[model samples]
Target: MSVSPFRIALIVDGEYISAWQYLMLERLLASPHAVLVVVIFRQSVATTLSQRLNAVLLKVLHALDGRFFSCKPTAQTPTSFLPLLGDVGCYAHGSKRYQTFVSTQRVDVAIELTGQAVLPEMVASTTHGVWRHFYGNPVHWWDDYTNIREYARRQDEIVSGVVRYMAGQAAADCVFYATTSTDKVSINRGVERTLWKMADFIPQRLHELATVGEALFQRNMRERVLARPLSSQDAVAPGLITTCRIALRYPSNFLRKLYKFLFRQEQWILLTTSHGNVTELGLLENFHKWIPPRDRFWADPFVVEQAGEQYIFFEELIYARGIGHLACVRLQPDGSHTEPVKILEKPYHLSYPFVFKHQGQYYLIPETAGNHTVEVYRCEEFPHRWVFEKNLMESVEAYDATLQEYDGRWWMFVSMRSHQSCSPNEALYLFHADDPLSTQWQAHPQNPVVASAAQARPAGRMFTDAEQLYRPSQNCAGVYGRGLNLNRITQLDQECYREEVVSSYLPDGDFDMNGMHTLGIGRGLSVSDAVYIHRRLGRLDHWIGKLSGFIDQLVWKHCYVLMVLPLTFLWLDM
Candidate 1:
């Protein structure tokens, strides 16, 4: 294929990072292309972790640009105005400076990989294409066929306001967008019906995928119904086969609740550390080795126990990338173990894989969090050849779903991030399954049981020590991971569940105060136990941090004084 070595200007938002962005950057720089990046950092220098992370990102970006293809990254200072013009703090003055620089910088294409909404006027002057690194489908508050249309309308209004800001500016020649599943209609429909009417919708090399969406929607319909609780259907309710057929035909809305009723259960006293500080709370004694060094990022871990062996499934994040694998190791009866073995690795990130054995068959359910789908895999030779069977849930902006079987019914609790805001405070959805491993999932009418970000994220599997079920949620009260606040699950079916923080671990003055790995429960040959692991940046990160500090000092002494000192005082007087 005859291709052009495009000159691309990428405006990146530092808030969200995904594998897609990393992969796209690799493609752009690997080819015979030129890229100028204007990175908008959302960090204020006041916070410790934020400053350190931003510094590391700066160093990494600098190294990448110097070593890789023709790439230049210019850090843009955020725009700061007196807090009241009703201006959503999207772009800054330094961003304006970079934009003006790009206008004359011979850049053919400008791609905004940050999921933030940008106006066409921002790149109307560029000759090459303008693409928005859109993630997920444009979700509306209301559930209706016209949802896409409404989303399109809002986008047009927002973009038009931005266009008016750039008077007489010509629109982009072609616009690029990343599509989402189910919302493919809404996204494309809105784009073609609205954005296209404004500018030509250009097709790009990277296409949107729908594998997870299609799989989840198809299989989950059957799985959800089987999971629903059987109530007093009373006089002449729908038959089981007919109800299953209808459920399979018309799946429940992912946002809707499937069941209601709460059951009080025991407490899961999990102990962990954060930011290098080690702290263990609750009945979580003899579980201190699980905490990792600070400077590493870890997520909630899932645990599984089968055949007298305990295993912990966790997300190993190295440098912010998800290491999707079912990390397994023997959890000795004495709460001691060997190093973890890389059990299973999915093509995409594999995390929170809830494993269980049913009638000599080992079934694994992994949360393909970013893929927007969940899948079940059967072990061909027990933890070796795991063939993909079906998806349990799909086409929803959800994460960290944990499945539980209670009162002869299987229920799944998940935190749904609203597509409208991509915020984590949205309600939690509960799904009931006739069979725990089946594809039929029914939604609870009261859907979102819990909607608070502070308690929404699940730490791991909801296990039953005796005959009761308990939910483990991340108690991010102080610093994000200072400690986990344990809660007793009081209800499950009626959706009237409440948690009282019986005990929690607090930071004990260590590097762990800033970061912590997730906590998990596992069982081994000798005894059943819990396992925890986290990633910590090597000492090299600290040295680099020190170096960056030195560089900042030098810049403050030389460049800062030379530029800002003279200009600032003069401008202040003016």
Candidate 2:
């Protein structure tokens, strides 16, 4: 049955919008269920001298700072978003033209794109009320400048998007929430990346609201993932003294960067437990370590046991090649290991070798996100040969495809990104099918079941013990792959999904440890991976140091990029 598309109206200040905001409009226009019926240009407002100066300063800093990380807010052009703005004209909120147009076109939804505060009258006019975004702390102003505050606090940013419905005249609904970490190196990339990802959810939610009526759409509602709405005590911008104090730390950071470039090396190694469940991983004494050579990193491990022999499969990425491939190593009885053998290699990069035995046949779903595919492989010969199976999902930026058979169906948990500009480590998507090898998969009603990077990326396989289901995930808060989050699934189905973290495991600072992410348990053994900031000079580090020296010489000779490039860690974005 063909249904009428829901009428969508955009509230904007002329044609000015962020590049990510333009992306949201294009996505909405592309959705079959949403029609951009009108674009109401907001009433013009004057900018104060201080506001103008602040804007210029922000632009100059961003342009200079973007060289370190090639991410900056895009300058706008009319032709870029003009086509998507249907029937555009300037109008006040309560103008006669606005009312007549809304009544005639039957505008179903209103989206605020002007960075304005949500008004009570906006909901009273539109049928489905207004949709707006708040990109900062949960309980802050609409357009809070949070990068400085978050950098100063060393905390993750909770980026939120909400829909204000006219239900008895109240505006408190955080419909979309993603609390993700900023970039470890550049906060500009971190902030921009988090905001760009919303291009996926804003339109997807509209489709759901139009396809399924409001009653069924909100039925079996998932848990609210945001903190309280904006409170009056929250300051929109940080204090000047506080920002100045934060900026003074850059000198120490610059010194530390030199030391790190010359002496530090980050390495990932595999760890195996003698006998421990997924929930309780036990102490360091229970683990046997497998350290790879300094040239390669072995991660995303999976295990298989056969006839008193154990085979460990993982992704091995050489530092020189900068690409990952599937490899396997045999575990010896005396807690030693044989050299790893190349298992599978393709033109594109691969990782997260999710192997399983279904219908007496061995299958593996390695992360082929490089090819934009969630591919399954069947083993023609054990531990050596693998042939192509079917593509479970195509044209998706999905990572760590983990499958579990539960409640008479097969559920797949995968982290996904909307596009290249967005980060995939913050959202967890769910899909289900009748059989493990089913060709068609059904997406959950609430697509992004979990939207926090702290535990969104799957770390290992899901397991059941004592009639309880547990899923392990990577803790990418402030840094990627920093720890393990052990979560218990309270509910799961097509309509709704929920999970709660029960425990956490972080590196104990032994051997200069920094992080642990992947985990797998089978046949009385639990295997995991840990990363350490080892103090050793490798071939790669040597070249980086050499390059740093060259850049330093150029920076010293010319004062052009001195304040911006040489003192790279500045007040612009920490």
Candidate 3:
């Protein structure tokens, strides 16, 4: 039997609508099992000089490019414009015309994307409920760390913009929420671009919102529900003096850049400790460093134990190639290691050599996403030679392809970046197959099961402790690979997927490490990698290294151009 779509209505601040908000509306219209019945746009009186300028610019653009560049109602659904002559919340709720329209449409739910507070009494008397979408720091408006100079200058603390959705009319009634960190580049581009970036995942989030809304409504009917008390963290608007000071200091960031160029070093270091010690301490202590030769680093370490012997596989990145290859080393019982050996190489960049054993056969699935394919290789000899096995997936940009077997199925968890995505590490995708090497893989109904950089990217191996399966994820909140998040997989299937974060490990010891991304354990030994700033050379060497790395990146980006240039010269000479 076919079920009816949820009838939804939007209450938006027409004065604030931009290209980004339009994109959100477009995505909502595209969602399955959801129908936008009516849109109510509340127009606010323009006060600021910037607001007045924007209004005039929008009018001119609309005259030239038509509705494409305008903030007016463009969706096919019915819409009504309401002018707010007084307080926005009180005017909206008290207007008889608005109330009549809501009654006529019979909206099952209402959503406010205006970032304005709606009274709880008004919301309860209206539709089933309302959801509010906030695009900046909800608790605090201005912070010293805001990505945009405008906001930073105005506020003393950094402005950490959040794309958040809160349920219920009151602030305390927020039941479901998701947050993504905004960088300076994104914030300076304005709200339209921010919304456009968020549009990639907001559609999926709306579906989740609908599901949660229905479930909460039913539960509310069965039992009395009370709103949680609001916390004391209130936001204060920024003053002009603070804003001017911040703007003046913004240009001085070049000094910090120069300092970083002079002294900053990013070197990947590997460490080993007892598994029990890691669980108890929540941080690794007393570790031995596995430092490679000059201008080379070892990372993404995977360990395999066989016949009382341990072998560690990692990605060895050399400065010249500017690409990584699968490398291995033998781990001795006395905690010493042998020299590293290159095991596998390809013309394209490769890293995250995820190795595992199945049916007594050793197989490897390194990140060949740069080549636009996911492939498996079989090790013919221990820790040295490997032959191409099969392509599990193709034409996809997937990273850190981690695999595990559960409930008689082979499941692969990877971070996928869509062509439209602004960041690659934020979206988590799943694929399952009956055979470990099967090419016929099925995507989860909810492909991007998680969409936050803080928890989506797979870091290393998945293991079971006390019958509970835990997956290690990268915490890319402040920076990529900043820490490790351990999540317990509570449910997994075609229709549904869920996981809860159990514990986290951060680099907080003597290493002065900035990041720890990978974690692997086998035969009572756990291996992890930490990133630290190492000043390896003086100023001259540093500049040379920088130039070399730049050239490598250029070569990687336009290898095809280099190939075509030689061919073109040969043809011209002939």
Candidate 4:
């Protein structure tokens, strides 16, 4: 094992690469702990005329739909000039020329961006062989697989991961995996968002290799699950029929957006009850409801009880402000509530007031992702006021950061966003420290420990039931906050982490419940929240907005969208 920086090889298609791949290269090259020792490029062969036409059509739609619907201006380009760094050898992989050049270089680890499985020869040439991205849910690691855009459009989600190919090993090592929601309106947007997030996979692994040393890194890699085996399949360009199907699906997409903007407003309300397993969604209708007015929504409820008095903390977002603020309300014995009081307000959006007790003192770490930091606040006055404590993390888009004490150490669980458009609901990261309020924390070697929309984001504080530690997670699969998953922590330590979903609590169809995320329990008081869909058809505050939104949709989709269709064909291959 060596503590020195790693000598890396960048293997890719020659001359040009996708913009997202270029981003990966930039991150890899920028790392002070990694040095680019050599590059092995495999030039792309020619494609059929139909394939070229398919690419052109995809380019036009991607440029238009991503920016138009997703409002992403800086979409990743399919083709970008590749930066030739270190000793470069643009030779066909596995060829005699490639073998000669690769053998001459002293490579620790190789990053393969050519969308190909690591060949046994390449694995033998390097110390740790190559790391590559594999796609699919159970992971379809096939030689010729469906394009991710088509897969996302068809499947409504994308799951991909990076794996380490160790020399002489039968199975590759799983380093990272993520299940991201697909932008149903725009397949290209979905692909763009997913790739931007997955770009960090290799760079993080490289960092571990450098700092943790090869022996521990390799051992930990093996401790995780093995990568899926690569299967063979025939792939081709999307032909006329597939293309027409894609075009036709947009009509429904337009209708869905129109329905949302015109007739509906996502009004999240909070539900609370005195007792029951809040993890179980049954009997929620019996719980009292805290509905907000049409102008805003109240959600993410965390009820705290002190000295026989209970206070409910939540996020209140007024429509005019378009940002969330921390607010709390005191619960009366007669099941009544006081007027909501603003507790802590910041210029940036804040939600998920993760309040917990540490050594007889109350501390709060809310989701301050808008400021790009996980900030901590200490409660000076019970239930209402707090002072700054410490910045636990910085310059990171971490969400719903929930901290818990386990194994005589403090652990923090959070969902992280790798890129701007990347969803934080897809990957859960773990960090630990000796002190609960410590600014410096050690990240778990295998992060994210779990990567699935069904169980990635922390729903609320971790609690124990029947002496078994349980953590609540949000199922943000098809819809945000669709349900809550109670996961039993099977393993948690400095080197490894694991959890199993013991039970799932989704909205009761009989209760007309739409979604839920947070759950609060302790002091003989248990509380959780649920959302019900409410149409703004009759509300006075939304009637005029409904009419205006209807017209806006018509004008934008029917007129503007149609007008740009022909222009996209003329935008040239991008």
TM-score of each: 0.42, 0.86, 0.70, 0.83
lDDT of 4 at 223: 52
Off by over 4 Å in 2: 1-4, 48-50, 75-80, 86-92, 102-106, 138-146, 163-167, 211-222, 226-233, 242-246, 282-285, 508-511, 536-574
lDDT of 4 by residue, 340-450 (tens): 998999999989988888889999998998899999999999888899898989999999999988889999999997788678798899999999888888887677777
Could you give the candidate ranking by lDDT, starting with the highest? 4, 2, 3, 1
lDDT tens per residue, model 3, 1-574: 1336667666666544544445555676667856776566666434577545544543343233233324332321223333312222322544786777645546555666553565343366444456544334445321221233333322211212223233342343433223343332223322222334544444554454455455633442222112112223325443333333333333334444566577677788787876773344237565556767768888898889877799899999998899999899998879889999999999988899999889989999999988989999998998799999989999988899999999989999998864432455767888899988999988775557775656889989898888888888988754567788888888887656678777787773235566888987878778888886675465564566567557645654454565467779999999
Task: Report, for every candidate in turn, its global Cα lDDT versus the true structure.
Answer: 0.42, 0.72, 0.62, 0.72
lDDT of 1 by residue, 483-525 (tens): 4444566666632334444445443323323323244554311
Deviating ranges (above 4 Å) for candidate 1: 1-286, 290-303, 318-323, 332-336, 424-426, 465-468, 476-483, 506-517, 523-574
Clashes of 2: 0
Ranking by TM-score: 2, 4, 3, 1
Judged by whole-model lDDT over C-alpha atoms, candidate 4 comes out at 0.72
Worst 10 residues of 3 by lDDT: 221-230
The CA-based lDDT of model 2 is what? 0.72
